[model samples]
Target: MAAAPQPLAPDPAADLALRLALTIRHDGQGGVADDLVDPDGLTRWVHAHAAALPAGELPFTADDAALAAVRDLRAAVRALFARAVPGEPSRADARHLMPVEEALRRLNAAAAAVPVVPHLTWPPGDGPAAGHRAAAAGAPAAAALTAALAHAAIAFLAGPDRTRLRACHAPRCVRYFLKDHPRQEWCSPSCGNRARVARHHDRHRPGAGT
Candidate 1:
């Protein structure tokens, strides 16, 4: 069995977007390494993010339509990030924007139908201040799950943290990542190594230095 990809960023919302973008891993040579193309794989992916979701917001199983919807949303997210260039206004071409708009529409409908209530809880120690929590208001599991994912995407794109969004610079890596530090680029150490090795080979390739 293939191991699940680990979160690469600190923020949960950004991490969620990155996770969806990487459901299908790419080989360093323009090929697929692992693919979560079936409904079972998608269900596992949904369950893995359960902690970030409100309780009972995810269904016990995923239907074919739900799986297809997730796949489409994943593609839209990847396209948005891939086309975004630094120091420019974030924009998506029509092909990508259509799906994004559709996702926003679905999210809006879900949120309107089943609102997430806000509540407060006390801190662990020493502080009397409380943190706010959002709980789903009894909606269908599939709708709730879709709302959660859509919320994450909106937060990542509309918030200031969107500046940190980046596509892994490693060759043939289709994965996206959030920069954790000023110098961070590759999504992981393995990708970093792969990029460095590729650079080394490029410099040594049959060059006549003429």
Candidate 2:
């Protein structure tokens, strides 16, 4: 049987962090139904989501640059998976790989900054009024962070298989993918064939003897 795509390591915290990056990347690549959303917009939405959650905080600012950084990180992450391996982070063009590694480190750090109660089970309606007041008090930082965390968790986990979470193999399809089948050899078979022909020509042409 063909080998299964390596399962993502099971660390909900890390998964959630990665999810934010995935969502951001998905939005950037227009994979979430091809809306062509800006990375910043996604970040704002994530931030808002985390804020709404009771156990998180919002950052001080959701400015263009901050969102841009988030976008850049998302691109870096997508690139990392696009050039993947049997297990995890695979090697690729250094030009692309370095940025992705850097982004992973930075993004992980950013995710760590927000404090989240991994899984909280509050008694139903026991003291919701107090919780709301507390959330309101923490809106700027704590509340926003909660929304961001929840967003990241949902984005990272609970999605399609890893195949849909791949990078285009075509020379020109450098962007991430979320639709092509996992067994697909190329973003487009025509492109795949073109690459094969190019490789064959390079290997067998004139002076290029085996």
- The residue-by-residue lDDT of candidate 1 on 55-170, one tens digit each, is 56555588787677666666556655554535422221222344545555654554454455545545687656322233535555555566566666666777766777776667
Backbone clashes under 3 angstroms, per model: 0, 19
Off by over 4 Å in 1: 1-9, 27-30, 33-35, 83-117, 121-138, 207-210
Taking the tens digit of each residue's C-alpha lDDT, what string does model 2 give over 1-210? 997565345334334444544452222232333211554565556555453444433344455555555555555555545444233331222345555456456446544544444343467867423232232333345234433553453344344444345444444334333443456554345657766887888898898974
Q: What is the C-alpha lDDT of each candidate?
A: 0.63, 0.45
Query: lDDT at 174 for candidate 1?
Result: 59
Best by TM-score: 1
Q: Tell me, what's the RMSD of every candidate?
A: 6.8, 8.6
TM-score of every model versus the real structure? 0.71, 0.43
